[model samples]
Target: MIIGSSERVPLEKCPALVLNADFRPLSYYPLSLWCWQDAVKSVFLERVSIVSNYKRKIRSPSFEMSLPSVIALKNFIKPTEHPSFTRFNVFLRDKFTCQYCGDKKDLTF
Candidate 1:
């Protein structure tokens, strides 16, 4: 999953959608994935990257390289934003105990 110098720019620092051979949308691929795979041939793009010269190349340390030089698939939907209320919920979920130091205190005047 190693992203080459070329692919880094067009992704716009965002995750990419990976599709199967059947063209069925599969899952999101982070930039790190490209770095991990080293090379990817399965790429289908809905909207091509506007930036020219954005070619992704993946290479394996074991002397293996994928074909198609990695495809630049379409951008997926944005992740849902976490609700602000979840912050408070998290505190209550852990009780009054300090998250770092699981201490339970009952203060009295």
Candidate 2:
């Protein structure tokens, strides 16, 4: 009994990437892609707006770097492989207790 307008649609309120019909990356916008806009194959929030386009500068928290704020990116170039056994493994093999003092042996030991 109720009809909703395009503005009332919840899907239209989110920000997403717009891909071309051939499955290529295109421009980004705040509004969600509608069926009338184009054939949206996928939507992702990979890019972060750290600074404005203008000359105005920005600063990150003092805990880390200023320009690159150590933010996580959406896409990873390659999957990370797990590391093999190392000297740390020998320490861990000892149940974190020093073989000599029985004290909790960390990397400092």
Candidate 3:
């Protein structure tokens, strides 16, 4: 399906923070997220409930709705004992600080 163009949203701001049915983030390590398109799709599908909204609204000829800032699933999902390994996860699990010097900026793998 066609996604956004430059004329639409500024890509960076359109991401929604995805939460589990319990209302906590789906994944704390990665700061669970979904793009605007996916968030909107889930809303229409009744798979998620909007917990918060951004001021911006997207409009088409037939409808309009504010972009979701936060969303939670309708069904609870059990979290795994071991979260998947990923760059963001690693950073998050480590608390985003350099272990050696305690610097909180410019971290990298």
How much does candidate 3 score in TM-score? 0.70
lDDT of 1 at 103: 70
> What are the per-residue Cα lDDT tens digits for candidate 3 across 3-101?
233435674677989998989887765589899999999999999999888777778999998878789999999989887888777777788988889
Candidate order by decreasing TM-score: 3, 2, 1
**C-alpha-based local distance difference test score of model 3:** 0.82
Cα RMSDs, all models: 11.6, 17.8, 6.2
Clashing residue pairs, backbone N/CA/C < 3 A, model 3: none
lDDT tens per residue, model 1, 5-69? 54445433333433433444343322223422222323222332222222353455765332332
| Pick by TM-score: 2 or 3, better one | 3
Q: By lDDT, who's the top model here?
A: 3
For every model shown, what is its TM-score relative to the native structure? 0.22, 0.24, 0.70
lDDT of 2 at 24: 35
Local accuracy of candidate 2 as per-residue lDDT tens digits, 1-109:
1122243334333223333333333322222233311222111233432211112122346432112211222343342264345556567677767777888835464
Cα lDDT of candidate 1 equals 0.39
